[model samples]
Target: MSTILFHEIVYGPVHSRRLGISLGINLLPYDGKLCSFDCIYCECGFNKDFRTNTHLPERENIKAALEDKLQSLRKENAKLDVITFAGNGEPTLHPKFAEIIEDTLFLRNLYYPTVKISVLSNGMHLTKTKVFDALKKVDEPILKLDSAFDATVRIIDRPNSPQYSVSKQVELYKKFNGNFILQTMFLRGEFEGNKIDNTTEKEVSAWLELVREMNPREVMIYTIDRQTPTKQLKKVPLEDLKKIAERVKQLGIKTNVAG
Candidate 1:
């Protein structure tokens, strides 16, 4: 199984197709994966295969590490567009997630006021009060919604909670009040002998309906950009992704396609 893991608390100012020049903050363990959803296409690979023996970085450690990196970058005058919260898993899962966000905000203002703060989440913990509030504070709360149907979500995201449903996710997203950004990964192939393709007319139509309801500030539509854990999966062509983006644009919501 191919995987890419961040083995540090604060990692690269890597060029992100969606978020731009981003300095990553890995709130999860430095050794393995920790996520609510075991996505087949996750570049970090499946959770079980990358069980972590390490602990989540303490709030103080994260703050210290981020400040140190920022100070160093400032001295060098490095170009950084955003500080992104994403790692092996769900960042909101951190116990002091809200406090950490506050620390990050302060540091961002002190170091790079113009730089944005983004959180790339699976939206599994949005119902949590702290997580919701923390996400609200960020510039881009990029939450994932790979499918509009519960069945399709289960197959693609494979959320840990058996009760996780698209309906619940939609309601949680509604709480954002059009303040969040909806991100969807479009792909097709077989998984465990089951054929999967979320770009179908039926799927996209249902997704567009939900998009209309959520009315997010923006929609990020993209296909697999990195090697996925599931070899059977295939990337949706750029033309198809642009077609989807056009549908989102028709909804009057800004759409960013990373193909």
Candidate 2:
């Protein structure tokens, strides 16, 4: 059981390889994971195994905890870059997601006006108007789009709903009006009896074509950096990641690769 659950509502002004000096907001419960996508490469293990709290954290409580952190950071004059909504699961799944984003932006102005507010989401909740509206407000609305092929998406992401389709996801991305950052997690592994790998030529080709369609602000490409729930999963090599990045660049899309 390789678990990396965030056990606090307000955690780390930790250094991020891609986003600098981020203070993470874990909207999910302290002990459990609740995400729409059960990614084989998720840092936090699978859903049922690690979940502890059924009730989502209260809006007031999250604000209080965040304010406390922001105030402390302000007192120290800390170099904060972004306030990211990413934790045990999909932050947008929180019922009061839009309200929280509103609170976060207000707080951002009061404490660190220049710092960006970001949300790390699986894009499953985009159909919901409120969730989509809130996501558009963030500086970095980072949405996951690991693969363009529906079958590969089903295998790699294991979306909770059987109805999950890549074409629909691309449409949701279109709603953003080329204003969002697209993130992809490239990996190779086996789940149950099936062989899983998204770094292949076929996978990348499909993905590249779709990335071109989205015409996002930028494309983030990365490999597994921590132990995944699935022990058999393997990280896509940096060289191979860069190769994919080069192809993405050829599409005239800026690509960011992280190990």
Candidate 3:
């Protein structure tokens, strides 16, 4: 039942496995989770378990808080590799997500001109014009696509939308024109009474076909790195992750594996 939640609007310059030294921005409520997907493996636990009563952070408050943190960091001359949009839940769910990205870009340029801005999204809000364009503005729009099949996605990501499909996600990713980073969480285990594994030959081959079609700038393949809500889940080993990355590499796509 253990979980992790960010209780601040602007927090962390934590070492991230993928993004390096990162400053996190939590646009969701500080007290609970508000995500578009209720993934079984989510570290924040289930959305129903952490029902939020607090409002999403205001754009103005986010701007002010972020600017203040950047200003302080600048004064201290801290090494920040990236400003990441990730928190208890989906960042693009914020009403003024686009404006907040604009604000973040301005502040980033003002404070850490070279530091990159990255958004770790579930790819649920890409259909929203503002969210799509806002994601395009960042240096890295790391979008998730855990499975090539809708059924597997339903079991893994448990997206709130019944309309979510791998084909639709691929179409949206195609719009990026190979500019986005595709992130997939590879894991094996059972959820509820069903056996789940995205690493099997069938799953990986189908996923690879989509990956080839999207032709994203890079693919990040990794496994569970922390305690997940579902106790049945198990991490994919580094050697196995490397093997997957090799498959991606063979397709002439840049890949990164984090075990």
Candidate 4:
């Protein structure tokens, strides 16, 4: 398996393809990953490794461990650009997600005061009041929106709820408005026997429509940069990514490419 699994609350200082040198906080289990969306391109594998009965670390424990780690790193004058909430599954799924975010804020202020806190969420829980509120507290809440079409989203993200529709997701994004950074993983390939492509002219047009409606602070355009769990997926080239970013920019939306 991959060493992305951290035994405790804190891990990394690892190079984040998008966020630079990041210190990760995995609120999920150390032994496995847990996320609301079973994305075909998930780099940490899948949720089969997750044991639901296993308990997540308590808030006090998280605070203590994170403070200890950050304090130690501060003493060493370590370089860290972001404290990211990322792991095997979804970090927002933790029961004390709000408390943990608060604690992380407290620690981030004390030690790396300039370092931003980011959450790489699937946006499945954005409908929940608590989840949405907790996400609001983070510095950069980068939510995933792989597609605007219901069928395409289902094929790509494989969201658990049958009722989780693109319309509902768009409704949720309306609430975030400028507070959120919309991230779409632009790529094309085959999964199972179905042909998949989210970077085509049709797909890009739909995405740009949403970007214009949401008016997000920025749009992060990128393709697969690692070995994904699925074998048939193909990466979108850098030129293609830049082209998509340029289209998004034409709509007056700021764009960043991590291809």
Number of the top lDDT candidate: 1
79 in model 3: Cα distance from truth in Å? 0.3
* Residue-by-residue lDDT tens digits, candidate 3, 92-133: 999899999999999999999999999999988889999999
As for lDDT, the candidate ahead, 2 or 3, is: 3
Off by over 4 Å in 4: 1-4, 49-52
Give the Å error, residue 222, model 2: 0.3
- Compared with the true structure, model 3 gives a TM-score of 0.99
lDDT for 68 in candidate 2 is: 94
Write the residue-wise lDDT of candidate 2 on 133-239 in tens digits: 99999999999999888888888888999889999999999999999999999888799878988887888888888888889989999988888888899888899
Better of 1 and 4 by TM-score: 1
lDDT of 1: 0.95
- The worst-scoring run of ten residues by lDDT in candidate 2 lies at 47-56
Candidate 3: Cα lDDT at 62: 96
On the 0 to 100 scale, the lDDT of residue 12 in model 4 is: 77
Model 2 segments more than 4 A misplaced: none
Taking all chains together, the TM-score of candidate 1 against the true structure is 0.99
- Predictions: Cα RMSD each: 0.6, 1.0, 0.7, 1.6
Question: What lDDT tens digits, residue by residue, belong to model 4 across residues 1-259?
Answer: 3224567678878998888999988898777777788788887775665455667878898888889889899989899999999876888888889888988998999999999999999888887788899888888999889988989988888988888998788788789867889999977899888899998788889878988888888999888887877788889889999998998889888888998
